[model samples]
Target chain A: MDDKVSIGMDSRRITTTQRETTRPFSLKRQPRLGESIIQGFLLFCGVLSMFTTIGIVVVLGSESIAFFRQVSIVEFVTNTVWSPQIDEFGILPLLLSTLLTSTIAMFIALPTGLAAAIYLSEYASSRARSILKPILEVLAGVPTVVYGYFALKFMTPVLKAVFGEANVNIYNMASAGLVMGIMIIPMVSSMSEDALSAVPRALREGAYGLGATRLETAIKVVLPAGISGIIAAFVVAISRAVGETMIVAVAAGAKPTFTFNPFEAAETMTGHIARISGGDLSYASIDYNSIFAIGLTLFLMTLGLNMVSRRLVRRFREVYE
Target chain B: MTTLNDEIKSGLPQGEAARRNVASRRRTGAIWRTIFLSATIIGLIALSLLIYNVVNEVFGYVATEYAVDPATLSDKPIDELNKDELVAVLQDNMRANAFRTLERDKPMADRSESEVYDLVIERVLKPQTLETWTLRDSWFNKAAIDAQVASEFPEAKLEFRSWLTAGFLTTPMSSDPLRAGVRTALLGSLWMIAITILFAFPIGVGAAIYLEEYATDNRFNRIIQTNINNLAGVPSIIYGMLGLVIFVRTLEPLTSGRIFGADSGNGRTIVAASLTMMLLILPIMIINGQEAIRAVPLSLRQASYGLGATKWQTIWHHVLPNALPGIFTGTILAVSRAIGETAPLIVVGASTFIVTDPDGPFAKFTALPIQIYNWTSRPQPEFAHIAASAIVVLLVMLLSLNAIAVLLRNRFSKRG
Candidate 1:
């Protein structure tokens, strides 16, 4: 009915335009005042996101300048001690802790996430996919704070029991990192599955036509084709692990020590910021300013990784279609 | 084929050896397939363990030792006592000065029956939990728990307690874990999310409209697109830092309600947090909204245009109605994400000890996640129990929101 009405209106408009050829034709082309205003409003709304980016940069940049003015760049980078009470402000310990946890998280997430993605994309039937996908999403939807609770209450105890009570601290980086990995598994798997599913079926069939097994086709043909997206997923997951706060803050202990041991307790950059800022700090205090410095560092690190991930997806994506 | 001849010259077997090689390869494939299947199972198991852990902590057995037993305080049960009787019991047991002070704050005569009864129990009965056991422990190790509680606190009564009781949802925050509740935090979360939606929905949808309908392919638009993508991936904690500087400090006059002549102290208001959340989730909403808008077929717009409708009219009358369900699904998902967010709100200064429900956007507040975070960080075991209950509340809220989004998507997809 709507289509018929539109056809009728189309012919009526054409007849009217043919009858009144003297009227200006360009008037309809120009946007009316109300149209322009609405468009301008929408454009402003789009620009608002740009403003957010600018705000983050300006806030982080300005506060970080204040922090660097008081503490030399060399000392901040080179010094291992992070005792703000004693006027020592090295970032190495926090940076190392961040790296340590992210590395541990990657160790757990990468293979498991990849395997799950391959299984879902290559092996799972549609009925199985429908059931399993929502389960993974529920895993994804469980809040990080709840994960933090599990890390503190459950994972830490299990780790202690497995590794011996003497080896694992109550608030170790391993428990936090392992739980962070668990928290991000769905992100990794879903993204990698998208990448794997994008690999054309013909490619998989070609591998199978050569008498290749399902695992071989998935591993050799599809995995190589979707490598860029899988790498993007890994990078994005790494950035997420590095920036995760509550799990580390709740379970990974607040002590910012220079250590490589996952069983020991130490603070990542995010954990430090969250733990310190959660406490009462007088405005403009050095302690308060230091969190911004850390935030700047974290922002730059994650931004660089995300940019790389985006570039990988755009630059290396195969035009299978 | 040449490699096969080379292998044959190198003393490789022909038929049986080739068959064995194929069998081994197939076995390896099967083994790896099992590994992959188990990987998926591991994720599901992790989810189950997380739920089990939270539920385990939410209900259990507690040994309570009251300073004054409720049985001794009244002829009838303590709950059945009238307001005046409860108030009289409070006066009899309490010091004169303390009772007078309570009456001075709010008259006992003016208080409701439940309020008076609660005060009577809080002050007079003072049921203190001596020992708490988890649900799993109470189930499997009941005998052991009973023995320990009986020996350790002979005066204490052991009873199964569900921390997530109806009363738990209605009460306010208390220093004592037994008396604590998530009412204040839940209100604050609702207020923040409400304001966040009010601001973010329009801005996000408008941005999506501009990107999809109005803006042509250009450097400026592409930069905006890339900027939004990067902002979406920016560490949420950095957004918290941005909120700390921009909303909580620079915009103190506005966010603190000083401009409105309301005496909300400082800029750590729900408005500030909500705006910060709006910024954090805006990219998500815009991206989702863009997808929803893009999904509206061009033929629909063309049909409206063919009917002598303006571009805006086509969008408003035809495209928007068609896209509304999708937009709602995105908005619901974004709001659910905002509900669970803790890091940004913490930096925006969510009060860990707030008791009063937030009455306006400018009021200081705590969210459910923040409450859980604060409780879990405490050294006391009971706080963990309450934190788990709060987790249950947060999960239920998020799951319901997600279910709505899913249902909306399913219904719309079916219709379309």
Candidate 2:
């Protein structure tokens, strides 16, 4: 339809006189009613994103409210146990596991990811950086489910060997945390590298003039300058780690425990949701609603982290500019 | 000071303290640099490890013992046998109830040659896997494996089997790992991706056009911009929750094919999964589209305007064509993500063990990643082997799509 209309328009236009004028200025084409329709359509499409947000909030809010009615929000927030199969509505255990996994992941990812960023920005030759950077991103391109299997088959066994098989369970948080950390390394490195490279070269030259070596300048001057970006990277990576599902589901068991021991098995919020939903549960069952309730918590947590990261990035940009 | 001056005048070496300081500082620098280098290499290591681990699981040797070898019965090459012949073999060999139930579940008339063979192998012979070893271990430790197999399962026959075989690809999901395949999940993934692109592409491009060309930098535009960036960061599992509530529950009539009067009227269908994926990739698509459109040279637009073309006409004729390749690059990346994602579908109720292929948007579905996840989580090690095979398929699909995008980007760049 569009092609036919366009073709018709091309034939109807008289080309003889229009081509004669090599006008310096625009000829002021008449604003047709069709233009307004197109504009409206475009604007409507843009507004769909906003509708998506509203949809998310409304859906989560309505279901979460229903969940709250069945289980008190205060108790859900404060209670320590999360045995939903037996009617315990404590959100603490899952929250703890989420926190524990994210913390361990951050610990592994932050320093190593930052070091890689520093290397790419300040140390690696241009040729090497070009070759290495995309290879690093291939890690990000990998599906999370593959990482889950890795954690299950490889990382856990390696951990078992290190910690002794008796100490590390077949399904444990250590493997999940380490693998999750590895999963987010590209996010941290890529973002931090961008921030690191954005720092003025003049600052490094100035530091060098003061007799600081490359290592000294990078750690003291460049890192400080790009600290906000690094922080933003950390926040975003943590948000990613918190929401990660399959790694924890496959490697980390479904048992929700309050213990923070990395060797023990635990379930994350996303893990719990995957497990419960995989089975047959009728609509509006408490078991069914609990997943939503857990999902709502996860949604808010990631949202908060994202907002913080955004704010940090904006602040850093403002300061630099 | 006098001694240092005398040494300098005589062209002598420096003292121990200064030499030690220089050596120590250089050593520290080397150490830190090595640390950074190691850190950089970790990503590469992780990628290799992932590939190695998944591929390692794909091919291997398994020790299997059948209840009754088909050779004991009449055999005119089982492969050449008709479906009826295979069914008769199953009926004679297996109990009446099991055979009848299997036939009643999905009629023998509909079953293909391979399916009949799979049924025969799975039910009649009941070739139970006694033990298994990876491809690497199987080759190097052939004698050891043979000894172990002899010791463990004396009656078992050991065969070098590539888990990702033709039959594995052709069969449907089954309770027995040996017979299970990704046929249903692959169809679901393709269908879901098709629907996702259909819904997201036009809308995403329109949004990009509005943001890049039409909208003024007013507060409303700023809000929309901020909202998009924020949406891109939202966890995909959250999108699943939104999908479960909105598409699955709230929009059941539309999503479940009830309105269209199609069979399999369930909200947790391909339509819902597709819509969820559409939401998941919508922000990414819009952002990439905006970048693609924004990259079109301003000179092109100016020339079009100078020729008396309206804004939309200039965009449609000149700007869009220029941006189309970039748009395609981004769309490919988004499509890969949509195909690989499992968490959102799991939340939106993609079945763990679906057998039948998803026929349409409103049919119940299971994607490749969901299948992989389900198989991996099973206690049976055989399931993990098949899951690895599925992962290989999924990765090939994803990486090839990305490779195409990269190629397109390169070609377009060269043209520019």
- Which portions of model 2 miss their true places by more than 4 Å? A1-31, A318-321, B1-23, B74-123
Q: For residues A1-321, what per-residue lDDT tens digits would candidate 2 score against the true structure?
A: 999999878865645446566544354565689999999999999999999999888877877888999899999999989997788999998999888888889988999899999999999999989888988867888889889989998999999999999999898888999999999999999999988988988889999997677899999999999988899999999999999988998998888888879899999898898888767768868888888889888888988999999888778762544
- Give the CAPRI rating of model 2: medium
Cα deviation at B246, candidate 2, in Å, is 0.5
lDDT of 1 by residue, B1-416 (tens): 99998986578546889799799999999999999999988898998899999999999999999988778877898777777787789999999999999999899878888888888878888899888999999999999998998888988989999999888898899999999999999999999999999999999999999999998999999999999989889888898989989999999999999999875989999999999999999999999999999999999999998999998999889988999999999999989989999999888899999889888989999999999999999999999999999999999999999999999999999999
Give me the overall lDDT of model 2: 0.88
- Candidate 2 lDDT over residue span B1-416, tens digit each: 99888877566336886678668877888899999999999998888888888888888899999988667766586667787888889888888898889878998888888889878887777888888888789869999999998898888989988889877777788888877888998888999999999999999999999999999989999999999988998888889888888898889999999989985756999999999999999899999999999999999999998987889999999999999999999999888888888888987889887788777888998889998888888888888799999999998898889889999999999999
Task: Kindly state the fnat score of candidate 1.
Answer: 0.80
Scored against the true structure, residue A312 in model 1 reaches a CA lDDT of: 90
Compare the candidates by TM-score and give the number of the best one.
Answer: 1
**Model 2 TM-score, all chains together:** 0.89
Q: Where in model 1 is the C-alpha error above 4 Å?
A: A1-28, B1-14, B69-85, B97-117
